[model samples]
Target: MQLLILLQLTIYFALVLSIRPRQCPKGLNDANTPRCVAMDGISDVEKNECRSAKHCCIGRNGYCYALPRKVVPTIDPDKTNEEMLSDAKDIMRSIKGGARFLNIGPFPSALLPYGGEDPYPGFPRLPAFVCHKRPRFPDNCDMEDKKALRYTRNPPLNIPYCIRIPCDPDLPELDESRTKCREMPGCFFDVQLRDYRKKFGHSVMAGVPVCQLAIRNKVFLEEARKVKDKTGEWTPYLNECLLDTFDEIIRTNHEGCKTLEMLEYFKHKPKIAGWKGIKEYDCYLIAGCWMTKKCYYPVDVNNVTVSASPTEHDDKIPSALYYGRPPCQKFDDKNAKSAIESYHSCLVSGCKLDKHAQNSYYNYLFDFGKSMDPSDHWVFWRLVESGKYGAHNLDEYNLLPKHDVTVTPFSLVFNYPAKPGESNLIDELLRPGSSSLLDMIKTGSGLQVPPAHQNIRDRFLEDLQGIQTPCSTTFTSFGARPCGPPRYKPTGVPNHCPYRPIEDKDLKPLRGSFEGCCDITLCYHPKEEIPNARSGAATYYSTWSYWTECSATCGKGNKKRWRRCIGMDQSQCTGRTTENESCEIVPCSSWNKWSRWSKCSLTCNSGVSTRTRTCKPIGGFCPGPDEEIESCNSEKCKIDRLFGPWSEWKGSCNPCGKSIYRSRECEATTCNDDDLYEIQQCPTGCGTWSSWSPFGPCTWDFFFRTCQKTRTRVCNGKNGRPTECQGNSVDVAYCIC
Candidate 1:
């Protein structure tokens, strides 16, 4: 009976939930909206009322509200408007088609340092350039000729923040000093300067839209932490690598001391002069501190300790943050606002800030959802809410109570020092009675104490009175004490007289202790023999004579000739007893005799003559000229000659066609005595001819009768034309014979 009642009550509750209407919040006037968007372990609905409705929005306090809507009117196009609209559509189509055009105009230069005069001056600096065409917004929702439109709105473009800002950050403005090209001190490494043009509609133009470069100075800072392990302990192996690299960096680049001027500038001025400069500055800070192993503060503020647990390590200690100083001073709940204001003011004043203030500012600029406490959470959410409502634009996001400054998480990592409590581990162990002498020694050299020295403590105490062993005597096997000689002699009987001059090959460095010898000053050194030894049986060797003449006269020459004896051992000579030397003879110089004189320079009159010679050695100095010159004789040349007309040829010098000679005298400036002559043919006079022929000799043919006719003539000359009538030939007429 109880089971049946429970089942009936469950069915009743299910029906009530299914039939119950969702109650909307007070500000909302919806009939079917759920009373609560989320239920406490009761429902599995994925979405809530505000999220489902098109004209509703969620508030920060987790309440849903209906949003007010305004109607917009449509436009009717005029002729001019229609034409412009068509052109705009065409341009948009072209841009989408990947057709690019030249966008010629002044680019925003405010983010860069101004080289020209500043027009505005004050705390809230004015923009270097204001767009006059678009009065309300300098950077409108447009780039060049194209409107800021996207192919799809569902998946937004992954554009960088500086580019997405409503007002172009690239525009020239006097708002704050910025990084200039001149201030960059090093080359860009792993740096990226993206145009953000692809995301912008007008970026297809010739000029890529300008945006802040993505600086990778943080990469260097990242490399700085690679030596640290997941546990945050800088192990021995890592220490070795870090120390060696740090030492090398310090040794090579010792310029760690930034000028006070530069430090003050960095501290007081929030704007950087150049992206490269900022990166170089970061590199300088990292290398310099790592070189000294001294960067240990949360804010990199001087003389403070910073310890952050690795991401993998849980908070073994119950603390929100770890730094040189607490994030802020202890405060009664009532004075929170005043304390916050003071902290904000300190940051603005360019004073040293506690770790919390610094982080608060960084979070304001680049919030990566890295919050450590409820207070930080509140600050981040407020900023996000402000952004959603458009109450503050992106450009004005950073214009809070504090002065504007740019910083990145990358630079902050360099300030993390070795983990807290680990730096002075050795000092803690060195406390009195903390470790035994043996343990200290073992730890010092990282080695074990030998068994022989295990009882050193007891032995040292027992022998505290004195050391009884004699200083200069050793025990013999027969139980006798052998004392060292007051003065000692060399091992073998002293080499009799003269000592040989030492050569490098024969010399041996002294080894072992130098102690009690009979002749301490000259223990192993033999004495020099008197110049002419009186006895022929003397043992010492003599000094070497002058080196013999070189065997050859040039290049590498050698000579060998000498001898010596020591203690009558002819083949056991120790030192160099022979002489050898190398020599080179300089070559002599000579000159070749002069060559035969060259032909005269000119064919007529007097002309110059020359001769030449060269020294046998090309570069050798000579006392004679390399070339000589003298005058030579030359014959006179003739000029052109003129000629006079010839006299008429003598008339027919020979009457019977005989040849005759005709000559004429001609004169010239140089050929006055010379004459001209020519040969000519003589004219032949007329020859006699016979009388006319008889008519009876005439004959007739079938075609015409024959008629008698005859004539005879004499030749005038060979020049005359030939004819039958003139050559004594007869002229005949045949008339139908």
Candidate 2:
């Protein structure tokens, strides 16, 4: 029984590993293409490269899939109409650009959201050139990259029109009919409207839902021809426009200070939009385009009312190195609170510190009322939660005012006297601003990574838990120098509260004790003095270690092993701590010879073929490519055109008013293989359904904690079917329990 259970566990884990999504290898990552929507404005030939017979798709590294139909936001059946609409409006307006209806055009001649023949110009006549290997978009790109692509520039706002069938992946067939889609009721996905949105809207909208933009674009281009940012002249552009544009600029173009900040001043403001807003790409041509520009909106007396508010900081800000003050200090007369608030805002907004902020922070020891208790002074507690004052990182931060402390990168700072015995006594340490050496060790992590530990998990285990740094708070680390009497009060335990510093016996009384304070977190020191053994039991403090891999794999190699003495500080385990030995393995750099040629790609007049070889040691590099052309039935036969067979008319219909298209390629001797397309209308009839199939496996519905099953049948493809179905095929079954 136990054996069976272990076998089941192994099988389950194997299945889990096998289910990983199929994807192109890492080498092809850089070759990945942009979204299919990006192809909207390209010439017809490019569009053809992106389209399936009845759908659109992007070419990925090694695969492709039709673009998903834009998913609409729908309310729950439990919600009221007003509740749903009100909620949707808030969501739409909150998006970066806000929901927009760009009604651009009297449209420059016959141009439209989809261009004419050119939009699909280079499309091949081959009916089998369809791309539907997967049911979803390729998940080959990094998620961050995919997300950023959606918020990028809108495609060319117009392309030519062409008839297409719905290729919704959920529907099981690409050529599914409109009447069948209408079965669910309420705003059937209008493919024409969807196409218009792709052409008119940004490739992927950040905040707006699909349904909202589709309507706005269709309404304007189909009737009127004008565009506005916020829909009215009186409202003026909100400051949000500048902020959103700034964010977008940083994401899409990470050049200095970001060009989009300056672009926002014009794109959102009519006066500037006339020229500066032509295109984001055009901004590059103008010199110093990223220079910051603040906007001053037009004032109108009729719509404005003057009111007094708290004063905004009016100090002159230098373009370079001017920083803001820190929070939780200063309580003088006149806006002293505001200074703290301003510094707090700087922290919240992630701005740097200025001299004024530093000066305000200098009042850390300022007297707060009559209470000596730190808690009573609520003003001092005015903090940016999750962080404290001073540099959050060792690589950054200013020296404390009038202090001898010097912080180094990735380590703590400790200051002690130049001589061992001359180190600052604990009485002097009590004085403010003294840098104590007995306070920088990381006890938790030091113990985590033992001298014996060679595995990857020791120090890593502590970091993965997210401990705060500036090790004093974390480890309460402290050290006392020289073979002197214990400083402060001696404790029973080596490291404990009101901590008594232990003497560093390793430091001889040479030229008096050179006293120092420092953190030895990951790095340890030599062992302190150990008592001379009276009876010679030897203690057995260290152990032997296994040898490591050889330094070299071919001809000559040497391997070594070592043990650390953990008794008394970091030394004193007797004998030599390390040993070395020599060993070698055979060379693995040779490659195998080439193999025989395989079959050719085609059996025609001439078809290309190839053979391959390998490197002896797997994964070693070997580069070679040679070609051979096989010839068969090479005799030329004169003919105008010899047509290949017609394409299938699957998932197509005439019952609900739609045409099925088929094509044949010309394959004649010494002739072009150009395609000739044929369109056919099937006999009209209301679709019929087949009998329901046996129920599928019962699966737990996690949300409801109940077992349920499903059964489905096709419309035109299943038995008893006459034409395409007008209703959904799949149905759910209640659990028998």
In terms of TM-score, the best-performing candidate is: 2
Candidate 1 residue lDDT tens string, 571-670: 4345567666667553434669889999876444456689999876654446667899988666543344344445567655332444665554333354
What TM-score does candidate 1 reach?
0.13
* Model 1 weakest lDDT span, ten residues long: 522-531
lDDT of 1: 0.29
lDDT of each: 0.29, 0.30
Q: List TM-scores for all candidates, in order.
A: 0.13, 0.16
lDDT for 553 (candidate 1): 48
Name the candidate that leads on lDDT: 2
Task: List CA RMSD, all candidates.
Answer: 54.7, 54.7
User: How big is the RMSD of model 2?
Assistant: 54.7
* Tens-place lDDT digits, model 2, residues 1-737: 22322332233222222211223222322212222222222112233433321233323422332333222223232345566446545544432321111111111112211322223345232122222222111122233434334322221111101101122324532123334432221112334333433454432211111221111112212211221222322101111121222222322322322433332342211011102112333222111122234211121223221111111243443211121111111223244344444333232221233433433432321322112232222222222111222212212223322232222222222222222234332234334563332231222111212212222222333331222232221122222111111222212211311111223344221111111111111111111100100001011222234466678865478988665432112322346778889877645445476566666443443433566666656533344433334454454433644654565665466345466777655556443434557677666556667787887876766543434577898666334545666756876543433
